[model samples]
Target: MNAASLLHLLQFASPALPIGGYSYSQGLEAAIEEGLVTDADSARAWIVCYLDEVVARWDAPVLWRLMSAFAAHDAGTIAQWGGCFLASRDTAELRAESVQMGYSLSRLIAELGVADTRALGEDVTLPLAFACAVDGLAIPHEEALLAMVFAWVENQVLVCVKSVPLGQVAGQRLLLSLRPEIERAVELARRLPDDELSNWAPGLSMLSMRHEVQHGRLYRS
Candidate 1:
């Protein structure tokens, strides 16, 4: 990847990118409320399963395919994938969280005058918008995929730390241990087909649904 593309990937993946990632725990809050994740070990397990089965099996591959579609300037494919992404989320809060973040990121990209902004438009999901931004910047597929997955893991780790109250050191350690899983996810993403993208995290989805009406909550989803 060129330096510009690399920089774009870094910026997109940054926690400070202002995508409101901190506001949504991606169901971690509900998991904690239900005691599914209470301590470092349980948190690590939850994250691992989530990244491997949920994220890898679902979002990563969808994002990768969306990147290809964006690179081709295929609005139809983007919209189809966007619908699938929206449908995959089993809760209203989760859907709102993703669309809001995506819309915000698209606006940011437009204001920044990033390439292919016209193709990206204002209505896009967070992951699809992210893929479009990086692909538009001409980042190599492998590097972009890896960076996105890493950012996702980092974000989930931060959420776990806050929700489960894991120590900073423990959180970092959990992230370190996920390196192999990250590599696996990247590899799986590369091989996944566009037609076979699906997510099956019933437990996580259930928590997200339950969280929408949760009497007391610290995170949005």
Candidate 2:
């Protein structure tokens, strides 16, 4: 709405934002290593499954609840949401990745002089802290959700570029192809019932767990 809110949303959503997002592959590297995502078609399918089942069904709804809690200034609810987010992470790498990025982003927001930043005092979960900071900064729910999903997609595409060795054009095209899916993810996120917030991407989670023990690794996760 306001210029500051718009700027905050853009800052949060930008692929170039310094949240250490590029360092983690979200288990895509393991998927690639296992030959599960060896080509453009496979990459697209893997990404679609991740978005539709894992993120849309699991992470997005938690983020929405975090945003709601932040908007309401409910510290207790926010803490509960953070616990839930942590529990949802099935692997050590996945858990560490989320917390690391969240800590970095929360520190970044504090340095940027966003008000009420201390609410995310220390060691907050990535999605919860992110949702809280942006919502605390007065960004509307729709804009915050859009930014969150956009960031998620951008990070995934970046992973695809490296794992699949896709050219920039190809990566952009793949990203373009995801617009419809992104819209659906956003819509599904908005309508998700509180009781149904669970990520069922067993393959993705297993890949992440395996990646932790992977030899000759190319990614942190």
Candidate 3:
């Protein structure tokens, strides 16, 4: 890809992008409280499961489809896929997180004049906003997916570091160890047919539901 596109993709995925990604753990905190994740090893396992199961099977593929829809300027397809994505959210908090992040990114995209998010309508989900921006910036599809996966992996690691009380070095090590799996997931996302795509992560979804009423939680979901 061209340097400008690469830079834009980096900026989109950066932790400092200020879309509130850092504030949400996507159920990691609930897992920690339940002792499903504790210390480096458990944290690594939890993140790996999320990557392989939820992301690889669901979010990444949906993102791939959304990016294609944006590139084609198919607003109808974008809305259809976006709605499907939102409906798949297992809990209220998870749905809110996606919408809130999407709204934030939509506003930022408007300010930068980088993408026309009107196609996504008012309730744009995070992947919809991201796919639109990537297409608008002319980021290549495979690279865009890689960047998205990397950003999520890094954020999950950061969540583990803070909540699991894992050392920075251990978190870094965990990130390194998961690189191969990340690459594998990206590939799976690229090749998986639409019919095969799924968001059937019952265990994780249950944790998210439990997190809704959990007192003194660190994450929104």
lDDT of each: 0.82, 0.83, 0.91
Specify the highest-lDDT model's number.
3
* Ranked by TM-score, top first: 3, 2, 1
Best by TM-score: 3
Model 1 poorest ten-residue lDDT run: 115-124
Instruction: For candidate 3, give the lDDT of residue 9.
Output: 89
Summarize candidate 1's per-residue lDDT along 61-177 as a digit string, tens digits. Answer: 888878888778788988888778877777888888988899888888878877555655544688878877876677777888898889888988898887788889999999999
Q: What is the number of backbone collisions in each predicted candidate, taken in the order shown?
A: 0, 0, 1
Q: Kindly report which residue stretches of model 2 are placed more than 4 angstroms away from their true locations once superposed.
A: none
Q: How many clashing pairs does model 2 include?
A: 0
Candidate 3 deviant stretches above 4 angstroms: none
Q: Which portions of model 1 miss their true places by more than 4 Å?
A: 116-123
